[model samples]
Target chain A: MSVTGPAGFRAAGVAAGLKASGAPDVALVVNDGPSHAAAAVFTANRVQAAPVLWSRQVVSDGRVDAVVLNCGGANACTGPGGFQDTHATAEHVAGLLGVSATDVAVCSTGLIGERLPMGELLAGASAAATALDAEGGPDAATAIMTTDTVSKQSLVEGDGWSVGGMAKGAGMLAPGLATMLVVLTTDAEVGPEELDSALRGATRVTFDRVDSDGCMSTNDTVLLLASGASGARPDPVAFDDVVRAVCADLAGQLLDDAEGASKTIEVEVVHAATEDDAVEAARAVTRSNLFKCAVHGEDPNWGRVLAAVGTTGAAFAPQDLAVAINGVWVCRDGGVGEDRAEVDMSGRAVTVTVDLGAGTEHATVWTNDLTADYVHENSAYST
Target chain B: MSVTGPAGFRAAGVAAGLKASGAPDVALVVNDGPSHAAAAVFTANRVQAAPVLWSRQVVSDGRVDAVVLNCGGANACTGPGGFQDTHATAEHVAGLLGVSATDVAVCSTGLIGERLPMGELLAGASAAATALDAEGGPDAATAIMTTDTVSKQSLVEGDGWSVGGMAKGAGMLAPGLATMLVVLTTDAEVGPEELDSALRGATRVTFDRVDSDGCMSTNDTVLLLASGASGARPDPVAFDDVVRAVCADLAGQLLDDAEGASKTIEVEVVHAATEDDAVEAARAVTRSNLFKCAVHGEDPNWGRVLAAVGTTGAAFAPQDLAVAINGVWVCRDGGVGEDRAEVDMSGRAVTVTVDLGAGTEHATVWTNDLTADYVHENSAYST
Candidate 1:
């Protein structure tokens, strides 16, 4: 159960022949509710997809009745024609749902700089609208996958309501949102402003912390729709926590399915002068190709960590820095400390902890090891 | 002839037990001069090697008598004890040459976070000093190899003087400097202040633009020593040009020998608002793993280029951008232009030109393609 796990929601997925392989490439989710409060976030990349530009306007009024997403073609860098394609898509979906075109959001994924197969896409959208069911959340999740090995969905229960979400991203995972598409639904009686705040707060620490490849995408988007069907207004703070938990769960699933990744690494920076410093330091380590490769080989090369940190402006003296691989403190006071042989990295998960020895703040960033498979997967063909 | 191509300079490389393979691991270059003038540049990384700290002080007074370089150990992140070792090595070289220790510079390369075998290093320095000859530049160049497949040497002749240099670095190449160690010798009658300015100007475009892997090392150093044997005193501008030419030659050689690289990429950003913006935009493209991988696959995936450009804070509207791969205008006005098949990438050199269409300034950054071989070579070893 994903978006349809909540009340007053229905979804469906259908094949559109957009992909040469004829995979399911179109999905629709409708919010049939007493209240249509919604919020969203998009990629920070300036060169956004046509769907992103269209959806930003659709949710600007804090009201959305439906969402239409398609895979197999990222209508990015497609210029004015692509924007018109998105506008037509929204209009078609709104006509079928008996709603205003301005209340329908659109999303797309696949190769950039290409136009979508409009005829096939429109036909698939009609089929999806006709097949809409309360149990179609799983099918919607499956339709949005590009290179993902598995579909991702999560659900968090509230007192009398619940939050459900699904995410699709396998590579180009980075800050300011991964190359991802996420949709969430909640049946709690919450206002649009609170929903927007909670979504931002949750994504800031969850989705934004996953820096798998340090490549931000032009088509990333996350949307949350709330319907007051449950009539349950739990504590606002508790509602926020549930939303965060759901986002965190989806983020973990995305990491687990990251393309060509054999190990999931958690880089934790402690004793930072500020939270921003901690984040900057951790991101530095996560983005170091040499460090990522060393972790891939389980070499326990802590010096690369220090070198990566040195490149940043975070407040920390070189002499006061320390690093640990797994649970073994391999470097202390910027020099060799315990035996590096004691650290084991044969497992699928690796933890690298850095002690800035500065102040009292910390942050963690998730990433993947650099592998030959990653290089091959990315180079063998164009995505 | 490399460093010893100039008159009044003696250099030698000798084997030291520090290297497990018993290869030539210690080198010495001496400036026997009527006038001793010198300038140097070290890695910008704050967590510098012990030898870098020692060499910065040795060249502080704009005079250097000798430079001692060793491979097989970087002596970085080794704390105060490592500093003491560098000081001792410099003092030993000074004792052999009968010069003040303050005028002797030192450089080290190889694995970091490890102490050098002081006994073997000092003994090797003595042997290098005893074996030094005016024609030993090539041997000194060969001695500084860590993983480099070939020794880098260049010579540029002036009116009555000449500039010659040697460099060694095959990986960890990035902005500020590759993980490189360079020594240049000149017979020009130039002052230390002019030499400093000339060296900075030369490297700012040459070595500083070679960002092979985006990993700045802790032990990068470049030293220029003038003996003033050619008292002709050529035009200052001509001397600076010669230095720049020599640096460019050596930088090209280093790029050719970059570890596990199959293609040398030149990312040139044109029509930028400023030179700095051009550099920032080009560097952003050079550092994109997806773009690099696409180059390795010989795929003219121009979308990756636009995505990379969109990540920078440089001046350019999304719709005004254009990119050409190998002189083929594949993307114009931020969308598809000429057929991508018109671009050819089946060669060792690949040029990606981005037109910001905002102004008139331009800059170029050199980089390497990401390949499975690069991942294997880096991951299979600790260095």
Candidate 2:
């Protein structure tokens, strides 16, 4: 079977005994490339994971040939010892692939502050490298998940090259980007600079807008690798389109699998003074627990929405704002507008639209309604 | 059954049909004195409640003889209509007591935006006025609660005067004073200016430090009424001490009854460059969901705590920070210091200390653990 992205990458996943549940916890990705150009986005959180620190240095040279990812142990807050483990992991992967150590990237997820079980991880990495195959993308996707109920993979097939990626995270999802670990691989002939620009542009609207729970993580990393095997150097605009589609698809999967989520909420803020203001308004409402709870209960509580929006520093006269939920205009000119009973929210997707009546700029943020299951899952999560 | 505070004030509470639960919802406090002075602190949220707007104007005169409180609807975001409801509620109470409406302060809590059921509320106010007695303080406390599992009341008896207060709130609790609605009654013979100074000073360390969830509310208000009923004036220091004690006790109650809260966590930041910096650091960790969840699971996740502190805009070298959880020094000099396996978390109260190693300034913020129950309660709350 052909992998989703480019044509010259092989992937493999295997159980590494890192998770008590015995799920697939190790993945290896290798590029058969003309040029090993890569770009990565690490979590903006100051509390960096050991692997993220290692990967940041490796990607500084703007080239990479392989990525080694392990789930079920986020080697974060483990001090210098954890950094050594990440370095060893990268070195081992580089030796196996016969590449420079700096040409290998590493990622880890799961619990924080725990030392990586290096003995088991090294053995698993060796087994995963031996098991690598051209059609192992799905297995690799499955291996990177923790707490996520399903594997998240997205692909956008283009004329000469394709964009394919996978993401994992169910909670600790919020702006500046969710606590997601993502890897995008493509055979498209794009340089590191172009890839970096495209990835940042794509993520700003897609992954960066999904807030499951208003929490930032200590370990979130998104890496994009361009093998240039297809030898098709598309224009920046076309490359951006592919990146957008892939990011949009992955974001959808993340929301669909949000922890204890019953409904995926799309908050669209339009007619704002600027795109930043629009995004600010939408995100403020998205992070509001009262607003999310109202959505979960199928109550078109426009009052909560207005209250949430009013708290944002965005300048707007109350009478100039309009709000609608599920296509029903529930508030206009900042007061009650139509019958809230007209809203229908008995589905998995819900939409809230706010018109700032200030300017033409707009933004959209995605979130999930707070649910009892979310509480149940998180309250007992650590146990 | 004497009220704890002043000598010439009577208080009463009555049931109103505004709440679906049919709990007490109307409270009345009357000062039978010649001198009446009042001061208030409203929610910092820009989306002010109708009551807050009205009380702000009334308290501007610095003289109020009575405070009428009802818990059924927050009367927030009801637009101009909400302001009218607040006005009419105060007028009704004032008319029944044969006093000017300007001398009466009004407060409301519960769901936001919905108009109060005037027919039931007016009748309840009439009943509360007739039932006013010194022994009705506890009943008045019960009437103001929304989702609060218990009533919060405190008393500080001084040589010449006394301070007593009642507070209510359960969710949307965070710094900038939480979602609290408090009424502090004092018998101290002080001017409105002094009352204001003491109130602000007391709140800065007490109510301002309790952060249950990060969400701020639109209806939080704290009113302090000086009846001057005792006819005995005390020194400023003694009066301030009484105010501080009352506030601290009420703040403790608020944290204990926080929504979905099973344990109260105290985050103390010490040796900071400034008091504001110390408070900021403590509050940052208190508001972190990751840290709260770790505490909920009885996991001494000090790394999450340090990560939270690092994210704050406060300036501090990571290596100069020390962290202790539940009296166990978990990290010192920015790295692991104690055996994680030896720490204890078997109690419902947890204390976390962070030393910045900068100066002597210190601050403590109270918070509650994040649990599944919190998620469960909030997710289904609106329904």
Clashes of each: 0, 2
CAPRI quality band, candidate 1: medium
lDDT, candidate 1, B1-383, per-residue tens: 69999998999999988788888999999999977999999898988999999999989999999999999899999999999999999899999999999999999998889899999999999999999999999999999988899999988899989999999999899888968999999999888999999999999999999999999999999999999998868798999999999999999999888889999999999999999999999998888888888999999988889888888899999999999999999999889889988888999999999999999999999999998888888887673
- For candidate 2, lDDT tens digit of each residue in B268-358? 9999989888988998788677677788878887777776786666667766778899888888866678877777888888999999888
Clashing pairs in 1: none
Off by over 4 Å in 1: none
- Model 1 agreement with the true structure over A35-90: per-residue lDDT tens digits: 89999999988888899999999999999999999998889999999999999999
lDDT (10s digit) by residue, model 2, range A202-285: 988888888787777777888898888888888789889988988889889999999888999999999999899999899889
Candidate 2, residue A250: Cα displacement in angstroms equals 0.8
Tell me the lDDT of model 2 at A155.
82
lDDT to native, each model: 0.92, 0.84
The complex in candidate 1 yields a DockQ of 0.75
